[model samples]
Target chain A: MCELLGMSANVPTDICFSFTGLMQRGGNTGPHRDGWGITFYEGKGFRNFKDPNPSCDSKIAELVQNYPIKSCAVISHIRQANRGAVNLENTHPFTRELWGRYWTFAHNGQLCDYQDLVTGRHRPVGQTDSELSFCWLLKQMEDKYPQPPQDMASVFKFIAQCCDKLREKGVFNMLLSDGEYVMTYCTNHLYWITRRAPFGKASLIDEDVEINFQEETTPNDVVSVIATQPLTDNEEWHRMKPGEFGLFHCGELADGNADQLIDVPFAEKKVKCQAPTEPLE
Target chain B: MCELLGMSANVPTDICFSFTGLMQRGGNTGPHRDGWGITFYEGKGFRNFKDPNPSCDSKIAELVQNYPIKSCAVISHIRQANRGAVNLENTHPFTRELWGRYWTFAHNGQLCDYQDLVTGRHRPVGQTDSELSFCWLLKQMEDKYPQPPQDMASVFKFIAQCCDKLREKGVFNMLLSDGEYVMTYCTNHLYWITRRAPFGKASLIDEDVEINFQEETTPNDVVSVIATQPLTDNEEWHRMKPGEFGLFHCGELADGNADQLIDVPFAEKKVKCQAPTEPLE
Candidate 1:
């Protein structure tokens, strides 16, 4: 139905090269041409952009193609209409603020009987289930704790509970962030790759372009990227099990081995985007 | 154009409440209704979702409304058409591979003469400039070095140079990551907020919802959120200047003083997503 792309790192890095390659999939090579948007984080600040045009033709998208916005954390999305019409209000990558901090979110799966989840306390601006889920999440957070968590461990435990509850309903693969850390969960298909020192050429699967990070980064650099699918054919992208979740902060897993991982088939390692609508398989 | 939402933190916390406010803009409150997507950095990997449907009404969006996906780093987006036809291939958030890592990206503005940016080596799957820009960035990375950078400083510098160069052409605001670090550039509207122990009640600009993070989070948490616009009306938001570019690492600006701020009014701060297609007034 659509595609997702994200990154978390220990050092600052630009994602222009990789982003450009993924953009090709929106009506250029693939079919996710409903709309698109991106977010870049800076020290307590950020840069963001969006366009309802296909990544293959949006002039604004072209400008982004030519620019190299860098950050420690990044998230992006492209849409392929399934349940709604293509428009500005229906694009992906929703955001909100909590505990004096801003939180970003994106999803790639569909659910049954989601209307039951919508609450008046947090209403949906648009009509998409993705945004509705975002609202529902906020309500739960407020309901669970009137204030922020006491520590990282406690917060993670609370979030873990939330995710488990959501997964039980349907495919709940998704991403969440507070700019300092990233939390990702997969119910159907998800993949990831980490980049550290000694970077090398990486060819884009959607485009015939490649980049050599070694020449452009220092030894202190540690970057990681994630997506609904494998962005490159040659790279090793790990797929999440049917029900799995993980957290990323500063280029590493923040859960600190708290979340369990399942032994997945190596063949499943091949990454690809997910469909918000349930697959007919 | 699309919308972007992000968050960062020093301690783990759920983004449900904040995400709820932002999701309201997905289709119910705002105009960006093309499609919706989001990413939650869960430990080492990311949980992402993309819907070809309006996030406002999508069932998955509804689940997100109620689900509390916790994360330290998060990114989200909502789309409005400008390039590719309405479909799944032309959504905003796009992912790829580079330097042996998954690179995720999303865009908002438009560019001119971007066709020249697309290379046969990195052909685009979408029809938007956003994807082409991603390819071009990858091309530069590949041509500049044979591998990933060994020095973090050198990589950041080069990326900044590239971003600055693109800013000269038009609005190139972008967000990207390889999972270890995040890179961001601003040519238009962008803002961020940091949240710590003293959380407060924040309301969404688009929807009739409010949350008191102080009631939900503890003092040890340091969370940050970035966006194209401030989701709430009461809080303060710092906007990016024209042609100003920078990065975010560890939920903060990569550069201690990346931009030399000048006295400007809010009127000048508004940079529409179509920077390349439309000149700044």
Candidate 2:
């Protein structure tokens, strides 16, 4: 129902190239034209630019394309307006403060009964199912760990489990970040590509633009980008299978289960039991 | 230590004229060159533009001046960085969501021993006395009323009382909004001016800018602007008292006690009990 674009980098890197390709889809190359938003994290600090206007013609989007805002982690979204009206409040990516750190989220699917999810301390400022689920996930995490989790593995696993539960309702592709790490859950279409040493040229699929990574970075630089669709046609993009979850930190896969495609029977059974007669969009 | 600018309008009006004057003080005309931020509320939706650079020369600030982002309520700040480092995280105005509404705040004064205030569900993402006080105030409000208050008068009074308590720590001049109303509390220098049917030419104090409101606004339009100092030299601005708190809604003074200069004895006693040897900045 929407589109997502995310990035994690070992060094502060700008998403201007990938963002250009993505903006073309916001009413130009594709159908997602309601609104668009993007967040860039620089160390523990972050800022977001959101607009209810279509990104294709937005002055702010133009500024973002021209301005090189370097960040370690970035999340972006273009909405199709499935659950909320086209307004600034309902624009993705939604952000909240948890554990004294800013957490950003962007969803790319529709949930049939997401309103059933109970939100505790964190509440959605906008009337969007995406924001509702984000709040619910954060509330669940806070409930489980009153403070920051002792181990990062447990936190990643818990987030994956929550994604599995959310996938049972409907499609649940998402991108989440807390400045340091990026967690992506794929219930449908999602792809990622990492650029490291020995990088080469890549051409955008949506636009007639090309960039040589060799000229853009040093050999030590590492950058990873995740998107609903691959932005570059020539690059080798890794497509994630449905129900797969991956965690990236400092531009590299950090989760032990990053490549694993384990099927959770509990989630499958719940989905089978609550399957709607009407097909999901 | 900083400067604040706020606007409350009956109609969705652009504050570009006033903002141009204020941005001049962010480096060109004054010493508040650390950072600047501005928030504009359109109905229940709002967006902010912030930069950890001098507003006088910031490209984003230039865009803000050129583009007209109309809103009914706005809060802005230019920081001199008294209690925190100069970074994006420490930029104002800070924002948080409570009771499904976005609340924005910007402070122009320092508070000693402000970290003692207990924060509840809300937490500050940035390490600043301004954000800490904001979170504490919101936490107090939530503790008293879990849901939206039935009577706005009580909420306004409670907020004023909280401001009174915070003023005991030191100078606590602040501007706050919950999308619907703009609340201004002055512990030192703060000024306001209202423009309605009888509009005339006004000249900026910090910049050579002049505008005839007769050509820009309608006769029925009611708008109010609040700032740490008078933005325009030609306009008659009302200077508030040290202990005064005023609430503006729909571009007009809505709080019954907006003009009352009441001194809470409890706050006075606390200030007397913890009076430091050095005068507050």
Candidate 3:
């Protein structure tokens, strides 16, 4: 088991403050002390760091606490080690090249017998079922589309079905990005928040940390963050249904289909958007 | 502070067991409670889920405890909000576009006077300094390369400088990735573990979860996970030092530097990682 943190925004930003508070729980306020890691997206590149130590005590963690490596998107994790060893190779926010683009992913669940499903050019680096499951998901996607999909909704639907079947083994809460859009699925635990023109003050439940967005952001900034648990103490959070999924692009809801957010019939929840050329009041 | 969870492997994997244990800490075993999210990678596509609720109590979290989504590199977060409202927009593990690639980020620290340092194409979406810093990092990189780095090491070095400057802001433990490589920096709190051919059983420190990778993975498999804390109870975790950065690619160190592990120069260790075309020996 581990802790998860991520960010998706219209602009480049840092997770320093939030991460600082979160780090306290990694070992000090909490007990995920098996290992820790973080990934920051700097354009086409990545600023990733990890260690087989607790965030609370790791000297590197202190550096992270003090640094402000900014990026538009970020994915981070702290482990409690359930399916893998405490080593640098087993750390998360795994990366792979597909369709000529880099894709990043993170999960917060376990699979029972996922190893049997892996089959393809891609393979697992470590021995965690989490990694095996990643291989299978990618294999299936590659099978469905040799290149990137033009219609994100269709692409997400296909993966949703795949995830639906994977649920048979165990939980699967995950985050994914192709440096363009972030697609998320909630088979179990997942939560999100969207910050826009009207910003506010927020506090951490795990640590005594708080910040006000109005003081740090512009009126045009729009950002959305997702994680395995709520990070703030004073705001209201919407809980994703057990079987739910969503997409974010440029800090807005890319997948406007309610079917992905609830158990409503796919047909009932489907909400297609008109092409940009055809949009008008 | 919040928690972060990540997994990088040669094969696809689902972080069910690890996430489950982490979820308990979201609002039960731990204090993170602003929002939650996760992303799964499927070849060139992605599946993501986000909710503005605590992972421990949200029914969606229950589903993730049961479902099984997988990916090679996965990032998840449980927030204790500090910048934006406890809504869907302020969660961590944000994603954005850069040079036609998808980037993801997650942070665990704070930054002062960061607003002045970060100013460019990448901007904050939410109110957290983490998102602002992410934007600043991306802006700097995008400006620096215009194109990707000539090599992984150069890119790592560039990012390392960025991390260094940001570290001066306060705390900046972070993770960044571009699907090809996962790079991380330890400003305050970060840690990771690598699971390889010789896998072993690991137990959760915060929840009742356990798994034996040796029983499920092939010897060729190499999986790495990074987080803010150790994910297992029975394991030796390495501490990442301050002012340290590492890269994980294909479940191995890309920098090819083994000395990255002993990076803790001083200041209580924060996080910890390596590669090379030119063989060291």
Candidate 4:
């Protein structure tokens, strides 16, 4: 098992504060010390920094923690290495291009017999079960829709269906994004917190650092962070229930209530995946 | 246009010395100030570092220069951004996984009417003639052989054939690799130099730096570097002729002489692409 971290913001925001807390767990506060990786999306573009070294002493991790790379969507992971060897290729936060958009994924749980998932368009370069699962998911999406679908709700439903099937094998908490939307599926131990106008000071649980959101942002700015464990001790983080799938867009949940998975006719799930205020491409 | 740099070595070697010279061209010594990126291959594993900011002053670039991440193969680029916007998406040294191997590419020249080269299975996530050309080439390879072909020489011939076609569009100088081999195609400007046993001192042309290879390398080390121009002022670099495609493996030219390309019957090309010592996987 490993740890996962993600962020979605209304404006281009950095994860330096949260990442600082997480790095401590990579051999310091915890034992997820195999490797760590992070991806930051800037508009339709993103930059990924990964190292097979322990994050606590990695020079690249130090740079990432210092550099305030602003992004609307971000996904990160620290691996403990179960299925794959500790190597750069097996590092977490894998990325592949789909529908002319870069899709990034990070998984926090182990799976058994993942080779059963047949892949077509996308294939894994690494030996990790996490990468194979990511490729399997993308292959399913590409097979289902050769192009971007107009109805995103159906796509999410299809993804959830696949996740449900994957969970039957083992734990399957995950964080996936396409630079615009972050879809988080939790099978166990996931939490999220949204900070908006009434932002306040928060202290990190792992590190002895504190930041005042009031000084760091404007009143209109909204940011949401999701992690395997809560990074801040003072903030009221929402603990997600098992089997819950949540979609976040611009620092807010697209689904009003993320607790229920209602069974509906395939044709009735026509809710557009894009925000109502934004025009479809 | 951009500046391309690549390395193929028999042993895992650090490129900090050569990269120190190349990064200077990103802005300090040349006009390629848009962005820069590099991919280092460690066995079957690889790590990529990219930045949209000028490499000369980039913090990430600084770290890459100071840190010595050793690898057997490397591909790097510094962009001037003629066809696409100066952004992270348009950064060079694009990567894609095929045949369970990561195919990395970096182009130093521009192409006209590149959109006409249709792509299938593989597509460009970034808007650049370079990336589109890479996708088109990969699609052609996948179409020709679904799996890793036993005859790699034929694959190189096919790649050269594709390069011959792409060259008709415009300047198409490029460097491509699959972790083991480095394929260089020249149209406008490209140079290479192989340094082995009798190592000598070398001085950089762009930056005020000098290194005596005798103190840095072992007698058995054989390393080859390909670049748009001779990086060091002291070394004698061979200038590749227009329309020439060269294949390098284990720091030596796989093709005995890279000066000529003969039109051979499709079925007659049976030269294996891998090093003689390496077993086919």
For every candidate, C-alpha RMSD to the true structure in Å: 23.0, 10.5, 18.9, 5.6
lDDT by residue (tens digit), candidate 2, A26-132:
98998888999999886567778888778898889999998888888899999899998888889999988888888999999999888899998788988888999
RMSD over all Cα atoms, model 1: 23.0
Query: For residues A243-276, could you state the per-residue lDDT of candidate 3 as single tens digits?
Result: 6777776666655344644433334432322112
Q: Please, what are the lDDT tens digits per residue for candidate 4 over residues A1-281?
A: 89999998877787999999999999899899899999988756778888777898888889889877778899999989999898778998999888778899999999998889998857788898899999999988988998778656567767877888888878999999988778999999899999998889999999999999999888977889999999999989998888888888788766624333333332343222222222111
Off by over 4 Å in 3: A256-281, B1-281
Residues A1-281, model 1: lDDT tens digits: 78888888766667887788778988888898888877765533344556556877875576567755556778888888665566544666765545534567877877667778844234454567777777778777767766665454456556656777778777777888767667787888788888786778788888878788788777866777888889888778878777667777777655433443223221233222112123101
Top-DockQ structure, candidate number: 4
**C-alpha DockQ of every model:** 0.02, 0.27, 0.02, 0.32
Better of 2 and 3 by DockQ: 2
The clash count for each model shown is: 262, 0, 272, 0
Cα distance off (Å), candidate 3, residue B131 = 29
DockQ of 3: 0.02
TM per candidate comes to 0.48, 0.91, 0.48, 0.91
- CA deviation > 4 Å runs, candidate 4: A256-281, B256-281
Error of 1 at B6 (Å): 26
